[model samples]
Target: MTEMRLTPLQYMERVAAHFGTAPHAVFVSTFGCQQNEADSERLCGMAHAMGYADAATEEEADLILINTCAIREHAELKVLSYLGTLKALKEKKPALLVGVCGCMPAQGHRVEQLKKSYPYVSFTLDPASLDKLPEVICTLLEGGRRRFVTGEENPPIAEGLPCARRVRHKAWVSIMYGCNNFCSYCIVPYVRGRERSRASGDILREVETLVADGCHDITLLGQNVNSYRGDCDFAALMEKIACLPGDFRLRFMTSHPKDVSDRLISVMAEHGDKIAPHFHLPLQSGSNDILARMNRRYTRERYLTTVGKLRAAMPHIALSTDIIVGFPGETEEDFNATLQVIEHVEFDMIYSFLYSPRKGTPAATMEAQVDAAARAARMERLLAVQNDIALRLATPYVDRTVRVLADARGKQEGILAGRTDTNRLVYFAAPEEMIGQFAYVKITRAEPFALRGELINPK
Candidate 1:
């Protein structure tokens, strides 16, 4: 007789039945990017399907899952520190199931360290092994040994997993997974695997459902969104979504300069109103020598040209960028060139980072590694420069009226927080009911990091 094969859903049912009438709770600790947040939603959804209630805090949880990031040393350190804190909780709850997944565990060294040092961690799964979560849970329920699942360098794309979205009006639809660009300074390709795009139909259906369900903001996510190759190209895919019948704003991120095409720019211009007028293009460094060493493949001039085209097409486009303060073989001239580019671009926002070496990446072993003090000094200067640019650019919007989505409750009482189409944070006084809805706001004041606004027509 042939052996039976059960799917993830069946495994979910098995776990749910194992819990029967008793209540179980799961606490999910997610660290890192927007992509990680999306993955957590799915994690929560799966846990629910397995009959685990969402625990408000770790103390109340029967199971704890830590979704980690391995992009930089800082994030990894944070995750490690967090895990140590969980040890006390695990000690108190002897039977608590603890799992760590995502990029960090995908690395062999990290997995071995967890196995040796963190025995309380019942299992570890990489992004590729995410779908096997229920099966792992079932095995644990049977009192099996510890499990460590290292995902393949290049794995197949998994689709149709249930996601318990934390936000009611905002959604992140991962259009593609993994990356092909092996940037010398990047660990993404190593941990997350090679690039693989979802079918165009799958993406369209997901967007359609979100729009039908009152989703007001949808972001298409990818390692390099512009490099998406589905039934349609990235530009064509955006056009299709933009044309969908909905009152929603579309956005994407982390575009590779080398992949930004003329068609993409044209499509964005055509759907400028439907698509948010904000682009997050990362310019790691402005020095050609540094870029060459980093294997970015696009020169400083090319990045500027792309930025020029984006602005030319949409005059009011808000440009944000990622900048690494120091890189291997960087000199004062290279750093100055970066500052010069920042000045030339006058980016609305800059996500600046001090370079952190990852063991497996080429940049880790390169000569002339920037000193910690030098990196810190350069980061300070970079922020000072960008702060001035940001203030100057933000001040002009003080008297402007803009559309904003009331996404969250503000830090203060009687306040609602929202973001404008250009991705500017706006705070206004409004009812809690206003959350998940859109409204017109008249900016009364502008701060360095946000704008103070009032609802135009309070309802």
Candidate 2:
């Protein structure tokens, strides 16, 4: 089947003529991972193409979108609280179009909760129905069009839509969508459906355009990139991107340990710095029992083997991971095992979370749910252990010279910060002209999270 494509102004004209009005302003509040951020960019781009200018604030917006997440109960509750606050605003401005989108609204269970509990919300759209955003927005704006466009037929691969990307320098390109690994803790597979890879030609073209558009870094976003199957596999795609005509960096994330292959590591090793020296291999729980329960499909030993192979391939690779502190039926012994794994791994970064049960997941109904207070304590201990390891790992950067790509300005007084090839955040004093370029910095200070450095003339 052929896809329908439209230029930015073409859609803008269609919306303008349909509504018989001038341009509108839009405001989108996004949550969750980089994939959601990237999806929001496309949403904003679609709005702009339909003659919608981004509002400075939600109060001034003609359309307000709540691009939400449901990974944890906390994430969902945050969105719910925000929606409660917006009810008065929706009352005051009846024409103010408000809708919920992304993973939360797409869940089959959340439909009634949105419709009954938050009736002020005019409509809902899933990530898959984003291509129909103009139609949805126009209908809702016309009044008495409250509905949900979710869990419907959603094709995985979407191309050629204009985007109002949040980060100009670092482009997020989705190589594939959905997750095949039904990790018991995750709702991604249920909401996002199964894995579907985009054509390699489509991905390469997107990268080429972003580079031409002055993007200095390209981050490939996927639930599980290692499972990507197209004209090329994940490793081949990375190699092709590394070979592309550009001086920019290439990075991907959230690789399932079970699917990550030697070929992928070899490709990164061969390409070296071009493909980045950072690998985010999530080790959810160190205990073999917990791993079996979570359906992660990999034992602690297997995960360590992958880490060893990665380090062997590229010794300087800065490692990062996702960890769950208090899983269902987790004992003190299991928690200690997790800490031991963290101590042994010495990851440069850890994205830790206290597991929150999601409705319709197997683990939610599982017996022996850990106490909230216990979870908090476990979380604190896990963080303390990980923080100490991170600090030690970062210490080597001190008195070393590293190349950093300036991505943004630092929070410190007149400081500029960027990231190294190993995904290390380095802050240094530099001119604003270096915002989107590479520069060498002499590391002077090393913290658990970031490195403080001084600018050095590139060698």
Candidate 3:
């Protein structure tokens, strides 16, 4: 595979010539986490800069990109299945270009497999090499058969990159890239590489620009956001972003329990009103034995203590978490311990998954393996228990007055949808003009997953 580089304009010219049009239509399908979503946005921005217009439908798109994820076996399979559909499209229109980019390509074996199986895919580019996308597209346009673009080198942190945002009021700001923590059951560290925080000045400038552009909410994205040590570290970054001039709100996710510090909690408390009162801390296992096996670096007791500290700092904070069920050698006692933690924490939301072994990870080669049927049963039971808790936690908010930033029009008549300060989805009846503004909403209904409210008055 030959590596190629081209300027943005030259890349656009090649694409336009290949498609026989100035504004070529492009469609992107993104999978996995928020980090992937942010990468997709940047990819779209690059395409837009290259004279490619957003396609209304896949059938109409001249170029289609599958921004993939390889966090789990199922996610990878889903991406491949999607690629199968695009195969027929490529056959019909030989000029139609298809590309696969993101974590899947970052892994050597997966890239080889993709090349062998999906010949319709024109190129494979890693997420970290986003700046090289124009060059990769240009190579494909120039009749390059196949190529894989990835390396250990950090690409330039290109600022002022144009983006076609999926939403108007909410924006995702990638403050950093990659992860350093190599948990035993995980593959993120291998795929995303080590933690590399963006400079504070770049992050602050991006946020300020979004604020000026009428973005009222921003989520600082990173693999392990709490580990972000820009100029001053995660705490300092939060303080600086919170103090920025705007009527905007701030939030972040996927905090490693080990990296979260008292100083960060204090910063959250100080800006509790401005910061969305939500935290998505991953607690993979509840048993200390399993925690150690998983290399989480924090025991169940330590995690609870950190939760306690956050609650004490911001009494009204809502908690969400990710839990992996049925890891290698997980006994009945270990599963029960996870259930107990769910009951105790009463998370606002829980992203639960049955552990699927990823081939290069340590857990895959471990001798112990839980039965598939048993894993499915355990996952169902865990979801049932967690859903009940989520409903209970959400019920109290019914009939309470909460502030919501109306982000979009709703499906129902004269309805609008937005998220609460705690990141709760709130649907309310409001006029269209109120779509990008904040308004007080009086909660009238509550569900396990969403809340219903009515607009009270403009702020």
Candidate 4:
């Protein structure tokens, strides 16, 4: 007999038959970057189509979907640790369906381990195969067997997937997928496959929809976002989105230094009103030799030059970056160079991480691997230096008035939180109704991590 392929409606019917008229709940535990978060929205959207409602907690979920990350060893370890806790839940509720998805399932070894050790997991689907989720769920329900569904070798872009965004006023739109720059220590390219940019028309339509739906902030996502090339380049695509009439600010991330072209900078400079004056260009290492070893494809001087161009174009642009403390064979001189760049840039924020060797990456097998303790110690020193810089940068925001989009409720009672266009977090006392609207806030005080402000205008 030939295998069957079902439409989304058929899948929903199958799901409905399995659970009957009783309500079913799904809990999605997402791990990793914004891209993963965006992917989870679609996962939940698929669950909704398959007749499942959102579950408040894992214990209450009829189906549990763990969206795994594979960027670092530490993240993978955390996923495994979390999965251990679910085994008991699986035993208690034998009817519960458990699935693992995302980058972790894309790896061959991880799938094998899940099959052998994690028998309770009903299915494992890779990120690119997300559209096939309902199909996998249907298979498990009908065939009564675990399923392993990997994405296509060179996956075609899946457009028009419904997204149930977690935040109503903020949204993530992936303009592109995957990475072309391998960067010896990175595994994104291998798991996510080659780069594929969504057509400009598709992206423009998505952004227009979001803005019309009252989204206040929109972020374009990709592993190497600046490298996007579809009907138009990344720069041209930004221009199109910026031209769209809306009361929203745009942001993008994980730009490779080499891809931050003058044209892109010029476009951003011209459209400062539409684009957020915040840039997140990663400077993995500041030492030329380390950068070469990492295959980052840009020299330290080139990286600095890009930053210079950005600063020259937008004087008040907030700069943030990602830094890895120790890579294979990093010397004290190299580490110092990174510190010097940090001090020189005076970034608004820094996401620093200690090097963790990932299996199958070139750096994992490279000679002169830095000691674990040494990496940890270096990370501590790096944090201290960045904290001081962050504090200094934040201090300037005090007594300054900024327009903020109140996106969340603050930790304290009767407080609302929002971020400035520069992506600085600000907290102020405001009404609950102000959560999704723009507000003028006068900065009262500043902390290294956030600013405390008083609401100047309610709306």
Report the lDDT tens digits of candidate 1 across residue range 220-277.
Answer: 9999998899888999999999999988999998799999999989999999778999
Output the lDDT of residue 370, model 2: 97
Give each model's whole-structure lDDT. 0.90, 0.86, 0.86, 0.90
Which RMSD does model 4 reach against the true structure? 1.6
State, as a TM-score between 0 and 1, how close model 3 is to the true structure: 0.93
Between which residue pairs do clashes occur in model 1?
Answer: none
Q: 281 in model 1: Cα distance from truth in Å?
A: 0.6
List the lowest-lDDT window of 10 residues for candidate 3. Answer: 1-10
Over 1-459, each residue of candidate 3 has an lDDT whose tens digit, in order, gives 235555665676666666565567889999998888988998898888777889988889978988999889899999988898888888899888888899999988889988898888888888777767777777767677667778666665666666778877889999888788889888888887887888999899888988998999999998889889788899999999999988899999778999899999999999876788888899988888888888889999999999999999988899999998888889889999999998998889888888889989998988778889989999999989987987888899988999999988888989998888898889998899998899999998888888998788976
Which model is ahead, 2 or 4, in terms of TM-score?
4
Determine the C-alpha RMSD for candidate 1 after optimal superposition of all C-alphas.
Answer: 1.8
User: Which residue pairs clash in candidate 4?
Assistant: none
RMSD of each: 1.8, 2.8, 2.3, 1.6
Q: For candidate 2, write residues 1-459 as lDDT tens digits.
A: 113545434545567676566667889999888989989998899888777888999888888988999888788999999889888888898788888999898886787899988888888888777666776665555443687986455475657887998776888999888888888888888878888899999999999989988887899989999998989899999999989887788999879999999999999999985898899999989999999999999999999999999998898888999999789999999989888989998999999988889887889988989999999999999888878888888998999999898888899776898999889899999887788888999999999999999999742
lDDT value, residue 68 of candidate 1: 98
Residue lDDT tens for model 4, 285-310:
88999999899999888889999999
TM-score of each: 0.97, 0.94, 0.93, 0.96
Candidate 2 has its poorest 10 consecutive residues by lDDT at 1-10
**Error of model 3, residue 321, in angstroms:** 0.8
The residue pairs in collision within model 2 are none
